[model samples]
Target chain A: MALAADPMAPIAARVARVRRELKDVWTIDIEVGSGGFPFAPGQFNMLYSFGVGEAAISISGDPARPNTLVHTVRAVGKVSGALTRLKPGEFVGLRGPFGAGWPIDVAVGSDVVLVAGGLGLAPLRPALYRLLATRENYGRIVLLCGARSPRDILFRIELERWRRRLDIDIEVTVDHAAPDWRGNVGVVTTLIGRAAFDRHHTVAMVCGPEIMMRFAASELVNAGVSDEAIYLSMERNMKCAIGHCGHCQFGGDFICKDGPVLTYRHLRDRLARSEI
Target chain B: MDMVQSDERSILTRAGLDALIGTLAARGYRVVGPKLRDQAIIYDDIAGVGDLPAGWTDEQDGGHYRLEQRDDNALFGYAVGPHSWKKYLHPPRLQLWSAKREETGFSISHEPETIPPFAFIGVRACEIQAIAIQDRVFLEGPHVDPHYQVRRAGAFIVAVNCGKAGGTCFCVSMGTGPCAKSGFDIALTELLPGTSEPIYVAEAGSEKGAEILSSLPGRAAQPAEIEAAEAVVTHTAAAMGRSLETAGIRDLLMSNLNHPRWDDVAERCLACANCTMVCPTCFCTSVEDASDLSGEEASRSRRWDSCFTMDFSFIHGGSVRASTKSRYRQWMTHKLATWIDQFDTSGCVGCGRCITWCPVGIDLTEEARAIRDAPAQEAKP
Candidate 1:
């Protein structure tokens, strides 16, 4: 019975770089002063904007480069807006590397299908980076991204660079676009039907709006993927990322603790129910 | 965990009761107990035995609470009140940390905890169970709440066996109380309070309690006196005011999430959050940030929050639980159904505070019975 360090206390991490990804989204690289922040693929950090508040933002940086602690934030709320407005030299309080991350080890030697929608892609970026760095370990890596429009797309350059790789297959879709658009023009779930991957061995990781995840999961199920092979990254309002705050509860599970990456087999019954 | 050593029993008189309070106060502990305050029994700092509500008992029902005079001059005659021992351990408001703007970025520092050890007097058995439930939530979880740990680590407990059940009590149905089962240093049962020679049959539940009892002016209780103490709890067990059938309760509520009974309860539930505030085990909280007018320093603090609030489940666009039916359903399901899945134990101890303190008189036991009686054909979306 020894006392542990305070879980709520935030360490001051100085912002090293801020890249504006979209109109309101900014990708921030923070220096945690310790020079190394070891975190898994999909774990999130509670980013605090000084006096504004805290928001649960996923660690979007590459796990190999632990010094470059990164978080991509959308200015959808007060705390996130403040974080997005931060400059390169400003400081923000950081408390995390929290929650269960994506099952990268479980997907070894298996084909990986990553379906991301809007800001949801930021959380999945770390996992994709890991899959590509260890390209020889995994099978066909397919990434399908969906945005409201071409302008709303995140990591546009990175998507193209990854698509250039012969081992990976990448597809981008927009819900609505101008006539100049020359790619997929439907929901991200539609790409699941035509994606080139072994349906029997593919481990699908989907992240997006709850509605989009539900439809994508249903589409995956229709594509001959087992329910246990499909994993979804869910979202909810959160305060304490350490599970002390009860805000992120989804039925029996605390998304902050048990998830934020849960299998469809685990969430199938609870996910279909509304207002859970 | 069952620390109660029933083999050791003693009888204490009125003079001995005063000595117990005096001894606790001398040990540098803040002795808190029930007191007559604002026409109700509230837990507060007590100086002596005079602060105890002598002959007052509370009459409680769904959405109704009144203080009544009892025939006997028993100190702890009433059931639980609106204020629970949580107000001392997990305070309604606590400062987590503070930050000051500096030249090179900023610096953060936690609020140095300075809480005195408390000696909770007159704690009910159901209330003790509630404290244990909170211990699991705060201490036994993956990440412990440091502030709660500091406040709860050194507290002393003195559990009082109930003489009569409250109008809304269901501790027997919850298998929590009527008698002090465990989690107390000492347990006391008031006996013959109306007679000239009133006494308290006491048992030490821990070594600390045995030491304190040895110092108190009490004698070994006769076998007849021990039977009287047991009889008091037996009478209370048979006199539960309400009961909840817990068999298959988890599946019953989880399977009927969309039952119409939720809508019926929502019609009466004002969602004032009074029930959550009064509930002994409701531990949800929200944090707030405050800064000086000069904007040089800022501090963040946590305040008790309820599921009834729209902001409790707010994401970016709007609240997840926007409708009253959804909110009410969330509260009840979390308490009775999902809580068991999350904590491995039911969140509720059946203290009945939620039923009695609800302004609209919405009783969960009735709502549960309604859904159980007529479950929906299939869970609607």
Candidate 2:
């Protein structure tokens, strides 16, 4: 409501916890100020590093706990490169809790299927926590995860704990692995076919590289899932997450405002094209 | 106060126009009007009536612009030029804020926004519509751009009806120009019937415009003179050189997303972005953070950007619209098709500055028509 204030003015957040996920990847938990805005599960934050630029990182923590904000960063660019090296008690600028998150309400009564690839797991982790917290709200829960290799797996301890739960079925695959590894060694779409689920009652949420998402969506389609039942977290160049900068325009929709999470029926045509 | 009444029309002599400029200046407003510079008429500081582009008209076509001498000293003799009101209102470069690293933390400071009230003279009807289109972009968005709002709020518009249509103009087709409608403080019509002394017919559109008109020497317009003023607008509308069909255009463009016509255009397009730069309504921008040599202080600034550039759509891996074919498709589809979906209006005001400024002489009207008239392609679903 305060249009007077500079929308570029970022609120300062203190880094409370920093956990190394893998090579070039880290999970940061920030102590958001009391005035910080509450975010939904799929929303993202523009994390700014002093002397460096900013990056749009999705909220990787639980949404129910409103005080602390969590984001996972890969050291790909100037901002995230600085972010991966940050320590506890350091400060970073934050602006948002932006974009539409996963469809928790729609997936409430139906069976839930979560598919994530590589670092794609970070954005969908919040939705997974929300689903686990309200375990009785949905039918069967199936999580299929894929990483480049065995050592690249994220949140290993948490995945083990979720594996122990009796109500949920979890399968993880690595594109390549060492000789000692004892799990599925193939691309993620293979797991989709093997996962046990009644296709008519299922709601699927997918997040990964664009190519991987395309292949996974095709696999889901081939396996009898309706287009409306499959959703994806899409990403493009994002500048002003509020939709004014014009960086995130995907056709008529600004990916930052209209979606980061959209149904397959909403984006399949655009995604099928090579460079849309 | 009756002199400042709404909808009052008056005839101002060529000399009285100078008084109007002096009156606006006395009210602490910087009066900027169009002047001939570098073979083009552009907005700049005005001293009086002598500073305007008098006795000069422009000839425009694809990839060409030249100034020509008019038979009479008509001030508003030409259609729109390359420079638009956005140069002052939304400005090409603006600093949002600057941050400096302090001893323990960082302190952010914003550059003081100092917007002087400005009286923009010689605004065309299509340019007015262009400004209103930009208003929807900068003001009506979810997060308003504060700097654009500041400059726009301080602007005083004096719109002029087109007296001559350039070779590339198509405002009649867009229904946005060739005549001034609303969104102006005052509307001006320059009449030159037979090379006699030029007289301006002024219509006050706002109380401020009327107040300024009250200070100038003018008289009530005769009924025949009023009809003559309307006739000037009618002639300009009918003289437009090009037209674009608007009915179901949004659907026609949106449905043919992958049409091969884009590739045909891409072969000729250098992607120099001259079209987007000259266009009055294109609002795309890129933000960059610049730190000083010491790397202690930095400011984030937003600059006008074009979608035709490869880097404009860059994400983590590479650009989204990488190919020239895709970039041209994105710009055209967004301007013609998806813009209707987003803004409920066409992005183009039909000024045709793009057609005149494009180096390849690639007219968008011709391109749109080619897409519509091409035999139904089986590949485009």
Candidate 3:
């Protein structure tokens, strides 16, 4: 019988541009034809590096600009390393816009608090861009970012430009800073106490390493934010973006489908358990 | 000649069995049935009734399976063997798609699937439930597996009622069955051997089954004869070798994640992955990519993966489930607890294949009972 188009098969997308974001991180802009790869803020794509393998990467670009799909990849593994090494005009296979994105809509009229750690900023960037573009749709907006050091800060130019605006509050920190580093020198959770936002009517979105997310989520709770008001972007080994491969399963949820973005209320019990 | 016809009740003589097999084969179906091979009854291509494991039954227990001879020439007296019906539907390995390099970019193309419509014979009630569970995984999801959809679309199922329970069988506790129900084209109950000859009480579950039944050499069964067929299943249900308390099982396992019982199971488990491989409802798979030496052609394929494997939960630096305890916990929890939350049903059909196939004979029922019998001091909090 004639088979239908495979959902797993990736469409070939040409690399529009590649910019080195850090020592081991690079952001690639992929051209996905004129139709535009429209996606929500916190979703991810399965990027296949030709002759190498596939990696799950969060969409790091502006959702407003759909034709140029942006993914910030860390060269920590074989597939991501292959993708980071690709030059402009090269081709990569793309299958995605998968998983639940951040609850930006739920944050309308409510104060928005964004917490990002290390490479975690990439996934949360789109939600930040959406909030900034609308500007008037939400209450007070606060962005707290943390990196390993001053050199590891992502989107430094953009963070500076956003800091220039009077409407939004921005805080940048480093875990271990050099003497020349002038910013706060502590983990991201330390910044949560001081950020100005209504604790009762606030929505928090956090993305980072598992340990960072765990502590950040607890700190947000201690800051009086409700569990349902907080969201965390989770990561697990994924093969099929469509939930066929069971690698990305976390407890009862398929992190690829039920979330990469999940409410803290849903993850409260599960997140506490180890090796789940 | 003055017999009241009943669609649900018909008597099939020994010759009628051959006629049923002939009817399916005539309809361009690759008839698959149980056969004696490698000292076990495994499902394979069957030509006719001669290929069935006649006068043979299987003795199964934890980490044990042996072929035994039954006194009567009963065609399907076995409980379950190593093979399940999943191999025909999901398959062990399948090529998802292939890609070719072009001057500017690459192009992806799917290999057109030509799945032969399968007619499975002698499927058990628990096996039918297992198929339904997998259906939820592959077809009922938001993204349907087109390959599995196609294979399942035209498939025909002929379910058989169990007359005798295996040493590891626990369908009664799982609420699946010893009697076929719901998901089948035709259901048959082999009547206990009487004076004259071997007879079967056949019932049609679908239109195709009815049509096929009409063509077979059989007569409308008497009311007493149908009761005899029902009695066969009732007797087998009471003979179950194992029983699991499924009440609050989801909460029980989730709450006891760090229980000391896990460490106990880890001590005995070899992490051989035999349970996951034998499980009929385990739908986990892994994708693999291969490229030609010239790098001109590349293909991606999906293969069956076991949760017991250290590589199953791999991330960037290392495998998440490195220890045998964690892997076993993941498998059992997913099957009993998380599965209901994910698919709205238990992942296990209580087929007992996992119990019989494990090298170390680690019975999940015993493990669960052990944990239930003695929870850690801090297991609740």
Q: For model 2, state the Cα shift of residue B175 in Å.
A: 1.5
How do the candidates score on chain B by TM-score? 0.96, 0.96, 0.96
| Model 3 Cα lDDT, one tens digit per residue, B202-256 | 9888889888888888888988988899899999999998989899888888888
* Highest-DockQ candidate: 3
DockQ of each: 0.58, 0.55, 0.64
What tens digits encode model 3's per-residue C-alpha lDDT throughout A161-251? 9999999999999989778988899999999999999999999999998889989999999999999999999999999989888998889
For candidate 3, the per-residue lDDT at B113 reads 72
Q: Candidate 1, A266: how far from true, in Å?
A: 1.5
Q: Which tens-of-lDDT digit does each residue in B207-320 have in candidate 1?
A: 888888788887888899999999999999898888999998888998898788888888899989999999998898998877788767888999999889988999888888
Interface RMSD, in order shown: 2.8, 3.0, 1.8
* Candidate 3: clashing pairs of residues: none
Per-residue lDDT tens digits of candidate 1, residues A75-127? 98888999998998888888889989998988999999999998889999999
Predictions in order: lDDT:
0.88, 0.85, 0.90
* Candidate 3 residue runs with Cα over 4 Å from true position: B1-6, B195-197, B376-381
TM-score of 2: 0.96
Docking tier of model 2: it is medium
Clashes of each: 0, 0, 0
